[model samples]
Target: MTSSRSDTRSKIVDAAERLLREQGPTAVTTRAVAEGAGVQAPTIYRLFGDKDGLLDAVAEHVMATYVSAKAEIVRAASADDVDPVEDLRAGWRAQIEFGTANPTLFVLLSDPERARRSPAARTGMDVLRSRVHRVALAGRLRVGEERAVELIHAAGTGAVLTLLSTPPSDRDPGLADDLFDAVLRRILTDTAPFAEDGPLASAVALRAVTPALDMLSDAERQLLTEWLDRAISAASPVTR
Candidate 1:
């Protein structure tokens, strides 16, 4: 019985998502979704409570699938030793494309309260956080990882929402790219750390890769990481 109910729930959500993607949010009425899923309207109400609840389930399902593919892409890029910046750019482009392609779902996630309640949303952030960590490991990040992730996420979300609000014909082709470049400029440096560049970037980078310093005893590695963390915190302009 539980399996049967779960299957029915999946069927309803699948139908709703298809409607959302092919048409728009307005097309996903309960009657339409019920017909699409070949289920009675009460079943949807029983399973999801209402339209808002149904939408939440759809958002979670869609984002979970997207994050799975995104994680694989990140893993493949890492295996290929792609430049960390390029990998991040690829991920950024993927996000923009996904948002624009699924405007309704993206809008659902635009709400901080809803997104915060989503495990898939948090996993998506972890992927972005890992990418930013790589940039720090490459010694090109000028800011701390948490700050950089926040900035990039905010810019990307705003860029997608702006594009979605405009008609496709009226949208600027370069807007997303320009915003990404601006975010990168704020978060990254042109080159890896050098002696003259000061200690912040180097400290950030060293802290990132500190776990791999296997020659040191665990206690020594811990001490070094603590020192690097202090140096990075002191030098990060945002921290002050």
Candidate 2:
């Protein structure tokens, strides 16, 4: 978009988000947003296609902030030699805080259909996948990398939603921490496992580095990945 169009889009999104924050989703009508943004209603249609499209942009704006923070956390791991598990925890806490603090925006971003199509939502998952890969490389993840990512994602989402559902005064403040610990216990080893402990941990660690195994032929890489996947999933519980 040109500078003018980009500025116009920003103004409209800002107005819509302010309405969403102050008065909930219903308050973000095109007419209201146009008036707040000092633009014609046709401008909103031109820029965003429709209100649903405008809301998608709103979700993207909120999720882009979230996903950028998450990406920085992932980038810091390699740059600073941070512990991957601790990095995961930091990201988890950030996610929880974001969700609980912006309940309306969180609801918009977390809607499954919107998430499926949202670039920012996918970027957030990519950050988590990277985080999980770091843990697997450290041999601290006792499950497959994909499985670990799913577990963490599910647990974190559930924790946020559960917290949001309760009245703040009645909510258990420790619940998020406790749930993270529980998930860690389920998906991690006390220490990096020895070869004899089980195939699961070893498989996960190897899986994390498989793409960088330059010596392997295409067929060999494919075969090795298939074997590791089978071994990892053999005992893994299915996501419901």
Candidate 3:
């Protein structure tokens, strides 16, 4: 049977996502996405407005995938009861794997246009900053003040972007986790003393970020949460 218009629109998005993975965001034009989805270029425009809109859609798709994979990775690994340092290492490794597997989408996250146009990108930064603050609260990491969380995110994102931009040959992919682990370790070590002491301290620290999460409207949070779930469902895992 012929697909419905909604189905067709979804196919266009799927096509955009694929082309982005195969040829980077630059290849994902209305013409290209339409052709890939076997629809006319006008259909793509009708569905998404313009090239930037398409890119925004694709970015939405990619961010969703990252969040889902993150949830899975954390859920699976949470059973390990590892030390704070080891927990950080595992998280770093999962992030590197996710990035390497979706290099094109990862590259798109680094795009200035994405930062400019996508609410998901902004929400992601909020979530990450919250996580950092949580670590500080839990005593797993040391962050001296509220502002320190933003400073840590700046440095961490810098490390992540640098690692993403560098090819494996230049700096062995195996070392990405170790390199980030070291960066996080140094940051956390300095803040560990300020952390609250308790058996559930780390968990409590993570909750500290709830205030940040609460900043978004309920509708916005739900929309983002659903989008993230769909993105993960759409992403096919690949070996690097």
Task: Go through the candidates in order and give each one's C-alpha lDDT.
Answer: 0.90, 0.86, 0.60
Which 10-residue window of candidate 3 scores lowest in summed lDDT? 231-240
- TM-score per prediction, in order, is 0.91, 0.92, 0.63
Scanning candidate 1 in windows of ten residues, the lowest lDDT window is 189-198
Query: Can you tell me which runs of candidate 1 are displaced by over 4 Å?
Result: 192-198, 211-226, 237-240
lDDT by residue (tens digit), candidate 1, 1-240: 999999999999999999999999899899999999999999999999999999999999999999999999888978989899999999999999999999999999989999999999999999999899988988888777888999999999999999999999999989999999988877776573354434677778888888999999999999998888777667776667
Model 2 pairs in collision: none
Tally clashing residue pairs in candidate 2: 0
lDDT of 3 by residue, 188-222 (tens): 54334443332223333443443467878978766
Model 1, residue 48: distance off in Å is 1.1
> lDDT at 239 for candidate 2?
30
lDDT of 2 by residue, 67-118 (tens): 9977886897879999988999999999999999888878787789988999
Clashing residue pairs in all predictions, respectively, total 0, 0, 1
In model 3, what is the error at residue 138, expressed in angstroms?
3.8
